[model samples]
Target: MKQLILAEKPSVAKDLSRVLGANQKHKNYYEGPKVIVTWALGHLLGLKMPEDLNKEWQTWKMETLPMIPKQIGIKPLPKTGHQLKAIKQLAQRKDVSEAVIATDAGREGELVARWILEWVRFDKPAKRLWISSQTDKAIKAGFANLQPAKAYDNLYQSAIARSKADWLVGLNVTRALTVKYQDNLSAGRVQTPTLALVRQQERKIETFRPQTYYVISLEVGEERGKRVQANPYEIKDQQTAQGIVQQLGNGRVDSIVEKAKTESAPLPYDLTEIQREANQRFNFSAKKTLSLVQSLYETHKIVTYPRTDSKYLTQDMKATMRERLQAVADFSPEVKTYIKNGAVVQQKAVFNDAKVSDHHALLPTEQKANYAKLTSDEQRIYNLIVSRFLMLFAAPHKKVQQKVTVKFGKEQFIFTQNKIVEAGWKTSEEQRASTIQWQEGMTVAPNFSIKKELTSPPKPLNEGTLLGKMEKFSLGTPATRAEIIEKLIKSELMERTPAGLQVSPKGKQLLELVNPSLVSPDLTEKWEKQLEAIAKGQFSSKAFLQQIEEDTKQLVKEVKQSEQKYQDFSLTQKKCPECGEFLREKNTRDGKIYVCSSAECSYRRRKDPKLSNHRCPQCHKKMEIIEGKNGAFFRCKFDGITEKLPTKNEKKKKMTKQEERRLMKKYSQEEPQESPLAAALKAAMEKQ
Candidate 1:
């Protein structure tokens, strides 16, 4: 009898099958002399929806707002039922002796395999192959050193508790809000608090008024001389600022203080840090960054797992640092500096067993990337992970900081400069460091200038800053934070604007109507800490789930009892053709769409033009097909360039009646025999 291996996705199954010599391919699995490999399409089973538990919950009503079922069963996803059946068949095969969980090595990955094993009633012993990367060597090593599936039971339990908590709170309150408000509204433990953060910033911007202020600074020395900057203080009034600038004279150096400082290289990325960096550098959304890294990890096998919270590696990983660095050195030769004696330099900040759990920081695997095959985006993300890995072995940056204090009449100004000692991980900072000529009791001329400025309003939170806030509060795990932010946008409760993330009018109203506790991060933070405790087996899942149920019940009751009202600020003046009700404009990932305000009316259409394959010459993105006054044209939204679509058989433009009349009136002034142009125009007009 042969052992069976269950993988998370078909592509991964194929990889496992190839390495394990399971070459005999079947409709849903691959078989060999020793083992059989089958695959799951992401998740073949998910928790039952509220309606699936209770028939009464199918209808949206306040009476059934808190629908808590005794057993939240698992059901086959509608689209993946066939795959689930395939896995079941393989599990029961006579030739299969035991099973291996070869899915992703994470909390959710554990749930994916466990749900299937339990559902199929596979009685055989099971083992789990846990590896961070999908490289051939890693896969082989993982199979050789398999762990008992029982080792991950706590992780699976934690996944279940988290899932059920979200369902309990998300569903109960979402149903209550939608039914009470008479509109499709959404609220969640994570998304609601995130939306509130954005709204908080908006309120600050709205209430802020610019106030004029002045700053007094002095520029020492003249052009072509040893120029240094000395900033003294800020003045509230224009006259005061001018007086300070006008009374400036020769000054004597008061004192100087200098010290040596050093900064270690930044730690390698966890999932959130990389997402933040990609968002800031490429302007890519957090979701986009996650997907890119996921592809790099799964498809390319160039990076480790994409979802992690640790910024450190286990002590065991120290031995592999050289190999990881060597892989990265191929792309970035600068990494060569850190490799010596066939190993990377050891650093204390990088390896700590206590700091690593679940998985280590996102890292580049020993497998080198095939640069030609990677897209530009994939290359960018891979580089980020690799460069950070190289930085770990880099020496700490050392420098000496000097502070000079000068007394100019009644004012004292201080100047600081950095002198580079040894440029380590970051060379960019060294360029700003220079030796300033200053000492005690030295005399120098002082010149001052006053500048008027206005107090600026607070900047809105972008996806990067928003992710930072979410991470700070433990609002969601690295795996789910992007989805939470995306859900807010899809629900029409948040929008991405040039200024950054902003709450839409609908979102603002939803916040006012939602329970105040739901909008605060404190509640979610408490729940998240409890979830972490549950994962570690310190807190009982039953107890944590009980707390969640009680909290969810209270939140639903608060939403139902609130006297606040919700208005659909998204409604447009345009009326729907099918129903007399007004249509609402919704911003979707696919672009804007118009929908009938009346839910009963099934009328919807795309508001933006359909996209075509023809790329814009300027931006290289797919252009929209728009029907202009003459004919259809390809319009690039980013480039704002339009070009006419090529026609089948080139045809002359037909003269309009207005244009023909104007042309004939001007050219037909007893000049039918005057020129050939007049004759042509007369002939065209006659034909029309």
Candidate 2:
């Protein structure tokens, strides 16, 4: 009898088929003598929506809310029903005596396969194929030692509990708020708290008042002409700052102290760390970084799983470090030197089994990466991962910190300097610090000055800082944090600007309307702790879910009873053509739009004016095409130049080849006089 193998994705299934010698491709699966392989497109089943369970739940009403069902049913995703049917048929085949789960090796992966099996009612002996990398060697080894599916029963229970809790809390709270407020606002157990973080920062920024402050500094020198500056003394009052500066005029160095310091290499990249670094260095959003890393893992097969939270490798991975290092060396010449010189050290900081979770830290696989095949963004992410991995095997960075104290009258001023003693693993140009020399107890004349500055407000939260905050708060798992940030942006609750994530007016209002329990990160942290316990078989899913159901009911009750009001700030005078409802102005990352305020209305219109190819005569920038009651016109913001847009039949006449040749020759001979339109056309042709 053949064993049916179910994979998480088609690419993975294809790899399994090749390694298992199941080369016979059927409609939706591969077949061979010993095994047959089929795949799921991520997840083919999800918890049924409230409306799907009963007809009464269709309408948005607070009375029907806290719609907790005794049994949350799972249904095949409508779009992927065909693939589900195919897998079901294969699982129940007469010749198939057993099934194998070959999905991703994590909590979510377990859910993907178990949900499908439950939906299909495929009762058979089942085993699991768990492996980190998709390399053929790993796959073959995994198949040689398959574990019973029962081994991950706790993991599956945890996954199911998470889904059910999200549905109960997210859907119920969202419905309650939408019905009570008469607007479509969303809230989730995890996402709401994440949004509250941004809102919290917004509150801080709005209430902050800048104050002027001053600092007095003294410059002193030691013997051998080595100079060191004293630390600035902060003064809140201008008069005091000026007095201190006057008192410290021409100060002399009284003492010098030096301390040696060593900084170990940074730990390897976990999903969050890499996402944060990518955001900081390339301005790539957290979601974008996750996508690039996932591609490198699944498509290129050069990196390990991307959703891991651990930053340390397993003890077993030490055996393969040399092979992994060789692959990294192929990408970087400096890494090649480290390999050649045998500089790779097995530091305990990077190799600890106890710290690892479902998967070890992200690492370069033994697969040799073809740099040419990677996109520019992928190359950047890959470089970051490889560099961090290589740094694990290098020496610690060493430096000396020197502080000089100067005495003028009764007050003392200090200057600090840091000098690098060894580059170590911090070999990058940006990591090096300048060196300074100074001797102890040497006296020299010093300059003094008062520097005035304004007390700054807290900087806005970028993707990196936001992720860091979420991590600190235990807001969401590394796998789901990026998606949470994206949902807030998509709902128009937050916006990404050059200044960083700014909470929208709607977002602030939503927070005010939400229950304090729902917006606190402490709630998510509590849920996560319980979920971890559930995964380890120490906590009961039933009890955890029961508490969530009670909490969800309480949240709905609070929303229904609150006298607080929410104004639809997005509402506009313009009406939706289809629904006759007042349109609301909404800002999206792409541009602005006017969407109907009514939840039942599915109408939206673009609000941004179209840009024409015509260039401005003054600034050479494209002009905007604005449509008014009178007619369409081209206006240039650069110079406020407005011109009537040409009619469809009044297109510019195409120049003949002879005319073009004459123009090119004329321009080549002398600077040619041309209109902005003519110059734009010429530039476009040259680009071609």
Best by TM-score: 1
TM-score of 1: 0.85
My TM-score estimates for the predictions, one after another, are 0.85, 0.84
**lDDT of prediction 2:** 0.85
List, residue by residue over 1-688, the lDDT tens digit for candidate 2: 9999999999888889998999999889999889999999999999999999978899878778879898879888878999999998888789999999999999999999999999889999999988878877788889999999999999999999999999999999999998888888999999898988887887888899988767655543322222233433346788987765565545556778889998898888899999999998999999999999989988899999899999988877777887888877766666777777664564567878889878888988888899889999999999899888888877788888877776666777666766778877888624323243445555546465567888789888999999999999888889889999999999888889999999888888999999999999998889988998999999999999999988998999999889898998889899888889899997766579888888788887679887888888889899998876698889997799998887765755756578999999988999658999999999999999
Per-residue lDDT over 1-688 for candidate 1, one digit per residue giving the tens place of the 0 to 100 score: 9999999999999999999999999989999999999998988888999888888988998998798889998999888888888888888889888999998888889999999999999999999999999999999999999999998888888999988988999888889988898788888888999999989988999999888877665565521121133432245689977776667779888889999998988888999999999999999999999999999998999999989999998988888878887787776656776675456654577788898888999999998889999999999998888878777777789988887777887677767777888888877774453445677999967666667878888999999999999999899999988999999888888989987998988899988998899999999999898888877888889998998889988998888778886677778899998778999888777889889989799888778798998889988999999865587788999979998886755424655578889988898786445588888999999999
Q: Which ten residues in a row have the lowest lDDT in candidate 2?
A: 220-229
Q: Which portions of model 1 show Cα errors greater than 4 Å? A: 222-234, 245-249, 430-436, 576-579, 587-594, 605-688
What is the lDDT of every predicted structure here?
0.86, 0.85
